[model samples]
Structures are given as structure tokens and as C-alpha cells.
Target: MKPEVSIVIPSYKNSPLDLENLHKNIANLDYPQVKVKVVNIKVSEGKKRIGYAEAANKGILRNKSDLILLINADTKLDKDLLKILVGYTRKNPEVGIVGPKVYSMSDPLEVSPVDLPVLSFNKFFGKMKKVDPLWLENKRKPFSVAWISGSCMLFRRRVWKKLSGFEKNYFMYWEDADFCMRTRNLGYKVFLVPNAKIWHRSGASIGKDNPERIYYVKRNSLYFLEKYTLPPGVILNGIKTTFLIFVKTLRYFLGEKEVSKAYIRAVFDYLRRKKG
Candidate 1:
């Protein structure tokens, strides 16, 4: 018998059309609907919007399936995506987390980052590249990755419990990386199953250019970099933070004040060790 599966989706003010479309997609999926449980934690437009980390944790904890899938509401999982991801995990007992090869919804040719080396603050600014020859060749099989994007990840219940779910401190950005690192440290494999794919509207949940989004990303990155790297990482993070502050300062004078302040506040808030 196929193992029970639960999809935990964290959504914030997504359009009804999108929600209808998501359910429509889910309807088309190859997995048996009877064996699959879908949990949608829709967030209201409140004065304080809950973070994805917090929302996702709630959803994961709400399920009791053998396999828990964390997927974004702004994504279209291929018909076979869930089936493939579950198949990969079931065949490889050592695997704790697995995600599909994600394609940008706007540009199908573009592949999202997953198979890169473990994240370090210094390499965080590397340019995004398109699918290369190596990427295509590897798509035929599942491959281990440093981290899988939180946009869509499948996790075993035991592993989720062991890691205590996403670090609520992250609140949103980079929590996926932190989760994957902890998963790897516990001697479990985190895989990117290229055979399984999804089209994602990245940053749709949080405004792509929102000041709040920038703040969380910059601030949360500091926590991740600080915890994962040694002394050198701290030094690099400081340098990068300084550079960002300077850049944002210039932007402040150039009429990009709100966004600029977001970046500035991110540095200060990280220094103060503030979190959700």
C-alpha cells in the first residue's frame, strides 16, 4: 500500500482564482485523493501577518500522515510531482527531505536553485544561472543537495519532529536552508528529484519587492550565516552587512527610502537578535 501523504500549504491572501487553480491542479495529480490529505492554512489580512515559518509549522503539526509535503500556494505541482517525490523517499529510506526540480512559472526554461553547494554568506550573492548541460543530465535521477527550497519540500514525519520543524526565528527567509542543514547533520539525505517538477511563482506569497520581504531575507540570512559558518563567516557577514547599509543609505538619498530603510533595519535588527 502507498504510504499516507499530507500536503501542508501555507497561503497568505492569495487570489481565489489561484486557490481554485491550485485545487484544480491538485485534482489532476496522479496520487490517489483518498490517500492524500490537503491542509490549507489561509492567512487573513491582519495588522500583523504571520510568517511562513510559523504558519508552516502549524500546518505540519496538524497532520499525522506518513509523508508531509510542504508546498507553496503559488505553485503548480506537475501531475506526477507528488507521486515522484513520494516514490523517491519510499525507495530511499535514508532520505529525510526531498523536493522537486522547480521551474520558474514565468520562464519554464529557468530552473530554481537546489543542487548547489552548502550555503555560505560569501556565496550567497552568486548569480542565478539557467539550466546547464550538467543540470539536464542529472535531471534523469535524484541527486543530493545542500538544501531544498521551502517553496516545496517533502518531509518525513519523524525528521520533521526531530528537527522541531522550521526555526521560527527565521520566520520566513532562509529557514529552508537551516532546516536542510540540520537534516543533513543528522545523517539523513536531502534530495532534489529532478524527475518530479513544479512551476512556482516565486515570491508571490510575499511581495517580491516588499520592504518586509527584504527585511526578513537580509536579517534571517545573518542568523543562518552566523550559525553555519565559523569566525570567518561572521567577518564576511559583517562586511556584507556594512556594504548593504551603505548601499541602502545611498538609496535613501535617491528616493528609494522605504526599501532602503528596510535593508538598514535588517542589519540593526539582526544585531539586536530580534526574531519572530
Candidate 2:
């Protein structure tokens, strides 16, 4: 018998169209023992907006399957995506989480794998890059990665229980990295399944470069740094990342003043939260 899999999609009212497409994609999957559940924040709580972590946790708590797959409403999966992900976990008990080789909806041929966290210029950032076609053709094996994008992730139900679901404090960003880091610390490996393909409408729910997105991303980066890094490293990285945010503010000052203000407010917000 196949292991049961539960797919949790956290979405809002504005994402209904995209959610419809995602539903169709999942409905056509070749896998038989799969359940798809959508937790609509707007409809469930009578609120227009809710944190991604909270919405995802809602769906997770309702499901009692052997494996759980968390995917974005704007993502469309290939027919075998679930099958491949489930296969990986069944084959390797040590593998805690598995994510697919994602492709941008605009460019289907391009391989957009989630970047591993990198420390550059004395600051940390997710380093995403399109996979070279030649390199992809040469290397077909699934490889271990530091972290995978939250757009689409699969993990054993036991692991989810162990971590107690995503940290509710993280409203939107850095939550995946936090979960992956905790999984690694607990001795479980994260892997990327090259054959399981997913097409993502990047930033579909939240417009690209929107000020609200800027605020949450900047605020959460600092929060993640504080939680994961040592005292001196956290302080140093905070300083370096703040400098980068300053550069961003300067660049957006003229055309997008709100974005600049959001960046500044993010720092203040994080600082205030730290103090209290």
C-alpha cells in the first residue's frame, strides 16, 4: 500500500483563481493516496489577511496522513510531483524534507532551484539561480540542500509534529529556512528532487517589490539572524544587513518612497520587538 499524503494549500480571497488552477493540477496527479486541503484565510477567519505560518498550521493540524506537502496556491505541479516526493521519503528515512526543481511560469524551460543560504559581503541572503541546462542534463540525482523554498515542500508527518509546525511568529518570510535549519539540527537531511517539477507564479499573491513584502522580509531576516546566530555574529550580521537595507532605501527613495519607508520601519520594528 502507498503511504498517505496530505497537501496543504494556504491561500486568501485574492488567490481563488490561482487556487482553482492548482486544484486542477493536483486532481490530475497519477498518485492515488493523495488528499488536497485548502485553508482559505479569508473565509475561515473572516479576515482579509493572515500570516502564512498560521494558515499552513491550520491545514496541518486537520490532517492525519503519513506525509504532508505544503504548497503555495500559485504553484502548479506536474502529474508525478507527489509520487516522486513520496518515493524519496519512502526510500530514505533520514530525508526529512523534499522539494522540487521549480520553474518560473514565464519561462518553463528554465530551472529555478531554491538557493541555499549564503553569507556574502558579511551578510546573509538566499542565493537563487537558474540551473544550467547542460549541468542539469549531466546530473540527474537528487542532492542535499541547506534549505528549500516554501513555495512547495514535502515532509514526513512525524517531522512536522516534532517541530510543532511552522513558528507562528514568522508572518510570511524566513519561516522555511527556520524549519529547515531546525530539521538539520535534529539530524534529518533536506533534499531536492530534480525530476519532480513545479511551475510557480513568483510573487503572484504578493506583488513583486510591494512595500508590505519589503517590510516583512526585512523584519524577518533580522529575526532569523537573531534566532540562529551567536551573539557577536548576530550583531555583526545585523549591522551589515542594515547597511544593505540603507542602500536599498536610497535606491527606492525617488521612485518608490513607500518602499524606502517600509525598509526603515522594518528595522525599527525589529529593534522594538527585541527590546520588548
Candidate 3:
């Protein structure tokens, strides 16, 4: 028998029409024939809203499937996407986590397999390139990566039991990479299945380059770096990464004053958090 699959989508809504397109895509997935369960996780409590990490944690704890596919509401849920991902995981028990080669909806060729968040200028600022010409030959092969975007990821239920899901405190950024690192630490590899493609409306759920995104990303980058950097490397890593932080601030300051302010505040907040 095929392992049971459950899809958990964490959405923050302004109105019911918020997930209208995403719902339509799911409705188009031939639900009558497909056997997967879909759980729509609303990240709201009363009038206020919660973070993606908290919402996903709740969804995972509530579901009881053999496999879990967590995706954002802004992604195009292709007809064959779930089947392909499930088949790959069923075949490779060694893979604790798997994600697809997601392309930007604005441009299909541009794909990014998330890299490990190491303390380096290149690691944080470098952009992902388009798929290889060989990919055009339709050789949708699987490859290992340090991490992949949280936008669309698949993992076994057992992995969730072990890792306890995303760190709820992270709220949004860096938690995906943090989870991947912890998963690998348990002797399981994280693989990217390129053929299992989908389109993510990049920055649709949250505006691109907005203050919230900028602040969370910068704040969480520091948290992630501090967590991963060992004792002996802490001082050196802090000095080098601090320089990159100012460099990032300068780049944003040249473009938008508000964004620069958010960057500065992120550092201050993270520092204050450290002092506490």
C-alpha cells in the first residue's frame, strides 16, 4: 500500500478570497481519484495572526499521516506534484526531507535549491541560477542539498516526531534551514527532486522587500548563525558577520530608507535579545 500523504498549507488571510486561487488549484487536483488529505492551517488566533512556524507546528501535531507535504498558499499545486514527491520518498527511506525544484511564477527557468546558511557574504547574497540545459532533456533527477525552501517540502512522519517540527520562535525565516540541519544530524539526507516542479508566486503571500520580511530575515540570520557557530568560532564569526550586516544595511539604505531602518532595527532587536 502507498504511504498516506497529508498536505498542510499554512495561510494568513485578509478575506476568504485570500486562498481562492490556491483552493481552485486544489479542487483541480482530481480529489476523487487522489488519496491524499489536505489540511488548511489558518495562522490566526482571534483577531490577530500567528507566525508560519507556529502554524506549521500546529498542523504537524494535528495530522496523523505517514508523510507530510507542507507548502505555502501562493504555490501552484501541479496535478502530478504530490504523486511524484511521494513516490520519491517511498523509494528512498534514507531521505528524511525532500522538496521540489520550484521556479518563480514570473519566470519558469529560474530555480533555486536553498543553500545552507553559513556565515559568509556569498552564502547570504548570492542568487540562484536557471536550470541547466540538460534539464530541458527532462531528466528530472534527485540531488542532495543542504536545505530547500519551506515553500514546498515533503517529509516522513517519523522525521517530524524526532525533530518536533520548526522552532516556533523563528516565526518565519531561517527555520526551514534550521530544520534541515537538524534532520541531517540524525543521519538522513535532504534531497531535491527537480522533476517534481511547481511555481511559487514569489513574495505574494508577503510583499517582496517589505519591512517585515527584511527584519525577520536579518534577525533570524543572526539567530541561525549564533546557533550553528561553535564556541571557539563564535567571536570570529560574530566579527565577520557583523561587517556583512553593515554592508547589507548600506545596500538597502541606497535604495530605500525604510528598508534600511528595518535592517538596523533587526540588528538592534537581535542584540537586545542576546543581552536578555
Candidate 4:
């Protein structure tokens, strides 16, 4: 029997053409037991903009299915993608959340950094290595990961309720990592289903180099670090992370003064929230 799946897409100020493309792609999927819900957030006078987490929760509340898939408005799916994800979850009961291999729409083979490593302040402060192309091409089996991008993820409806959906305080970023960490604390595993793939127009909803994006990312990183780190490590990591942020601010200021200012403001805002 085919499992019922609800796809929740959170969209903000998307163009009519983009919505048509997204709907058309979903319509072509081979899966018969699927429902697509778009939680649209429009910006206008006397209306406040809703963030990704809240928008997603709104869509989730509208559907009652066995499995839920969270996807962004800027994504395009493959015909068998939903079938593959649902089939994997049905077989692996221990896996609570599954994310697909997302590729750049402009360059199909270039995978998005959705399959991220466990969060570590040391790594954040140190030099990072690029993901090897050989490993990406060779890894055909589903494997456990620290977390998967919320851009395109599948999980059981029961699990979503258990976690109480994405953390609303996150507003926009780091919510996926927060969700996965909480899911792991409950003894469930998060996996990357390499075979189920999709194409994403990276940062289409928000511009890639937008200062607002930079602010949210930096602020949210601090939030996650504080929430998860142990006491002594928290103090140590906090200092290290702050220093790293300062370094980044200096570097960004050289090229983009507005983005640098946003980064600095993010640190101050995060600190103020912690004290209050």
C-alpha cells in the first residue's frame, strides 16, 4: 500500500511564474497518495512577514497524513523522489527524518551542503574542508547524518508532533539543526537518502548575499551554540565563537560594509536576548 504523504512548501513573496513551476513539478510526481500545501506569506501594508518556521507550521497544520515532507518554494522535484523517501521510511522505522541529495539547478552534479556534519565550535573556528566529489558520487546507500536541510526533508507525522514542529524562535535559520538535535535526543536517527534527489535555486527566496540573511545566520548560530553546549565548554566555546565572528566581521567589512554591520549587530542582539 502507498503511504499518504503531505508536502508542505513555505513560500514568501514568490512570483506567479515560480509558483506555477513548483506546482507543475509536483504534479508530475509518480506518487498517487500525495497532497501539496503551500503556505504563502505576503508582505503588504499593516501585515508583518512570517518566517520560515512559522510558515511551515501553518502548512503542516493543514494536512493529516502519515508522512510529511517540508520543501522550499524554490525547489523542483524528481518524479520518483517522494516514492523513494516514503519507501525508505516505511522500511527503516528507526529513522525519524530523511533528506534528499539536493543539487544546484544551474549545475546538477554540484550537491548542496545539506548533509552537514555535527555542529562544533572548534570546527566553526577552524579551517573547513570542501566536500569531496568522489565521496558524493560513490555514496549510494542511505546513511545517518547530524542533520539534513529543511529545504527538502521527509519525516513521519508522529515525529513532527513529538518535536512540536520547528522551533518558532529560530525565525529563519538553524531551525533544522535544532530539530534534528532534539530528534536525536529522543533516540531517533536522521538520514540522508542519496537516491532521492532534487534541484534548488539557491537562495531564491532570499538573495544569497543579502545582509538580512547574514544577520539571521549569525544570530541563530549563537542561539544554537548556547542552547546545546555544556557549561564549561559553553564559556570556552562562546569566547572562541565570538572571536571568530569578529574576524568575519572585519573581513566582510572590507568588501561589504552593510553585511559587516549586520554581523556585529547580530552578536549584540544575541547577547541582549540572553541577558533578558
Among these predicted structures, which one has the highest TM-score? 1
Minimum summed lDDT over a 10-residue window in model 4 is located at: 119-128
Given candidate 2, what's the lDDT at residue 96?
96
- Cα lDDT tens digits, model 1, 78-169, are 99988898888988999999988778788776775432323222334332233453455456777777776788899899998898888878
Q: lDDT for each of the candidates?
A: 0.79, 0.76, 0.73, 0.77
Candidate ordering by TM-score (highest first): 1, 4, 2, 3
RMSD (CA, Å), candidate 2 to true, equals 3.6
Q: How high a TM-score does candidate 3 get? A: 0.82
Name the 10 consecutive residues with the lowest summed lDDT in model 2: 114-123
Q: Residue 26 of model 3: what lDDT?
A: 67
lDDT of 4 by residue, 187-252 (tens): 999888889999888778778788888889888877887787666656776788689777877777
Q: What value of lDDT does candidate 4 attain over all alpha carbons?
A: 0.77
Show pairs that collide, candidate 2. none
Distance from true location, Cα of 51 in model 3, Å: 1.2
Candidate 3 per-residue lDDT over residues 1-276, each given as its tens digit: 566677888886524564777767766763344466666777777876677888888887777887898988878867777778888888889999898777777766665333211222123323223334335235466877777778889998888889887887788877888888789889998888877777787677668788978888888877776776565455665676688778877877688678878877888888888311
How do all the candidates rank in terms of lDDT, highest first? 1, 4, 2, 3
lDDT string for model 2 (89-199, tens) is: 899999999988777787777655333222121223332243444475445689877778888999988888899988878778878888987888789998888888888
Query: Over 4 Å off in model 1, which ranges?
Result: 43-49, 113-138
